[model samples]
Target chain A: MKYKAKVFVTLRPSVLDPAGTAVQSALTQMSYNVESVRIGKYVEMVLDATDESEASDRLHQACDQLLANPVIENYRFELVEAL
Target chain B: MKYKAKVFVTLRPSVLDPAGTAVQSALTQMSYNVESVRIGKYVEMVLDATDESEASDRLHQACDQLLANPVIENYRFELVEAL
Candidate 1:
């Protein structure tokens, strides 16, 4: 069997998000009444793991090596049946 | 004074994600050896809520009315200090 996971990786609490800041500023300037802005990365992956544990492990590897920057961003995810 | 929320809205258990399917097909064709494919939406919003409770309420409203297709996707979120 196969599984799918959606991984969300975001800037840690202490990091400054300049892109989000700039976007928020633009939105506010446009009269959107925005207060603050945050920018994060989104990734969806389909893996070869057959069960939930293996899927989680492979997903973690993907996140650790290529999907996210552990130095500055915190990551979370959800795993579910692909179909 | 301000708050930041990251909203992730994904296809519900039964909805098919064609875009994600196409992307996964491409990956497999490229020798990525992928299994199944699923796709979801990611949104980041900066709101004017003064406290956590209000922020949650505003975020929920945003997700309900504008951020997600409630009929097909389930939404999840996290809130944190912007800076």
Candidate 2:
């Protein structure tokens, strides 16, 4: 079976995001009245697996081992059967 | 009122994503059985607005004007009242 995974990788709240800070400052200068901005990465993938459970497990392992840095990031994923 | 917005910026399907390709190749070499990978940006923001409609409008404007590249990327956002 083929499954599609949508993964979100975000910085832990305690971790500072300098890029986000710079963008926020720029927006504020542009008079956007922005309160806060946090930036992260969104990854989508299609993978072959035996079942939904197996696909989910593989996706989680990918996030933990390859996609996300556990020390400064947190990750989450959603999986669905793909065409 | 404070509103939270989750924005997703992705490359149009017709556009090629080199970074995704590199990652996919690496994953395949690692024996992950990955079919395809797409990479994008996710942005979260908290903003002050008069109502849900206003918040939604502001978020859309942000995506259109600054956050996303309309030439090759598409964007979508979700807005919710913030506690």
- DockQ, per-model, please? 0.29, 0.85
Q: Write the per-residue lDDT of candidate 1 for residues A1-83, one digit (tens) a residue.
A: 56777777788879998877876676566545566566675667767765788878767766676556889988899888777
CA RMSD for every model? 5.3, 0.9
lDDT of 1 by residue, B47-83 (tens): 7756888878767765676556889988899888666
TM-scores, in order shown? 0.60, 0.97
Report how closely model 2 matches the true complex, as a DockQ value.
Answer: 0.85
lDDT of 2 by residue, A11-66 (tens): 99999999899879988886777899999999999999999999988888788878
Q: Which regions of candidate 2 are displaced past 4 Å?
A: none
Q: Kindly list the per-residue Cα lDDT of model 2 for residues B1-83, writing each as its tens digit.
A: 99988998999999999999998998888779899999999899999999998888877877888899999999988888899
Per lDDT, the best of the predicted structures is 2
lDDT value for candidate 1?
Answer: 0.72
Q: Chain A of model 1, TM-score against the native? A: 0.93
Recovered fraction of real interface contacts per model: 0.42, 0.79
Interface RMSDs of the predictions, in order, are 3.6, 0.7
